[model samples]
Target: MAAQTETVQWKLGEQLYQNPLSGEHDVSDFIMEGQAAISFPQRRMRMENVLDPKLGQQANFVFWCPVEFPDSIAISWDFWPIREPGLCMTFFSAKGANGEDLFDPSLAERTGIYPQYHHSDIHAYHVSYFRRKEADERSFHTCNLRKSYGLHLVAQGGDPIPSVQDAAGPYRIQLLKWKDEIVFKINDMIVFQWHDDGTAYGKRLEGGKIGFRQLAPMIGEYANLSIHALERG
Candidate 1:
């Protein structure tokens, strides 16, 4: 049988949200789960753990953009890995399993722990692009995409990012989600593409919120975060 392929047929429409994420006031209304020391040392938002790293997951945190986005959209941002021995993730299509707001007071409270997210009451798509937390990660770099309500890893691609020592970055991280397709790229280079059939990973995840999560002891700087609606060509 001939292999199948999907044609690229969508374009980014009007931007839904944009933030420099550069200074103190840029994130004034942002919501945070767990504890992190957020600063703007180089005019770029820097985040790291406040609790001792030895505390494990308790020392990690998630900073949310607070804006709910539609199912089809394009998200772009600039990133810099300052320090490692930790991991970073992007959470999207997130909401209470019963369709409550991600921050809905009625849902279970979350504090940046891994299980509290995957094994708990919410559903979200998680992508770990900068994964250097474990010994294996440091030795073999890979970008992973997982769907949750359960930690089901669905796609993976080679991570082309260099380690901190050799990284000279303002790496443009881009994610595009349209219908069932998810594409991830760095500096215009395609890293991976997955087409979700919906039923395989529970119900198809639609519109919800987006958040930036970091494991303890990792320091990263971010700027120019923007989201554009995905429109069919």
Candidate 2:
């Protein structure tokens, strides 16, 4: 019913997928839904808005990896905050409510709209790790994990990433989903961990696509996306 309040020993299995995300070839198969510009000027994939920020929510977007991972896996990536004052999220275990592929043509149109992903026909677990958008959010920095077919805030933890002016460089971020539990870490420090009771959030999500989503006017860089099979030791 609960994780052992001690160091978790995981025997990571075969690497499922790996990408440097260094250039266009690495993401040639990726799908971008919304109006975001992507480039690799620094050998790292940079994401920013193509639309005017004054468009508000309409300027946001999601860039999705084409891989469909299994239920129990570890997703690891490197993150760099270039410019701030916007939210950044990672959506995993995303699929249609009835278990359709994330990009299925039958699925409702999604154009970086928040409600389209959370309130529409899809079910996903999204972690908002860099939340500095609004005035209140900037005042108190916290990483929030939400389960949706509805935006259900299930977990939260204090965010450790500093402001852009104070940020150092590529920070390692990892998200582990093994069975019914989820753990999020940054720079090898556990930011939050949660167990899904299932019934509370309808059902625990599993095995789907992973995507990077950014709110308007924010710029960020990403690299070294890797997913691995995980076994508890």
> Which residue pairs come into collision in candidate 2?
none
The superposed Cα distance between candidate 1 and the true structure at residue 134, in angstroms, equals: 0.6
What lDDT tens digits, residue by residue, belong to model 1 across residues 153-203?
888888998999999999999988898888888998878888888888888
Supply candidate 2's per-residue lDDT for 179.
Answer: 79
lDDT tens string, model 2, 4-75? 334456767989999999999999999999988899999999999999888888999999999999998899
Model 2 regions more than 4 Å off: 1-8
CA deviation > 4 Å runs, candidate 1: 1-7
Q: 25, model 2: CA deviation in Å?
A: 0.9
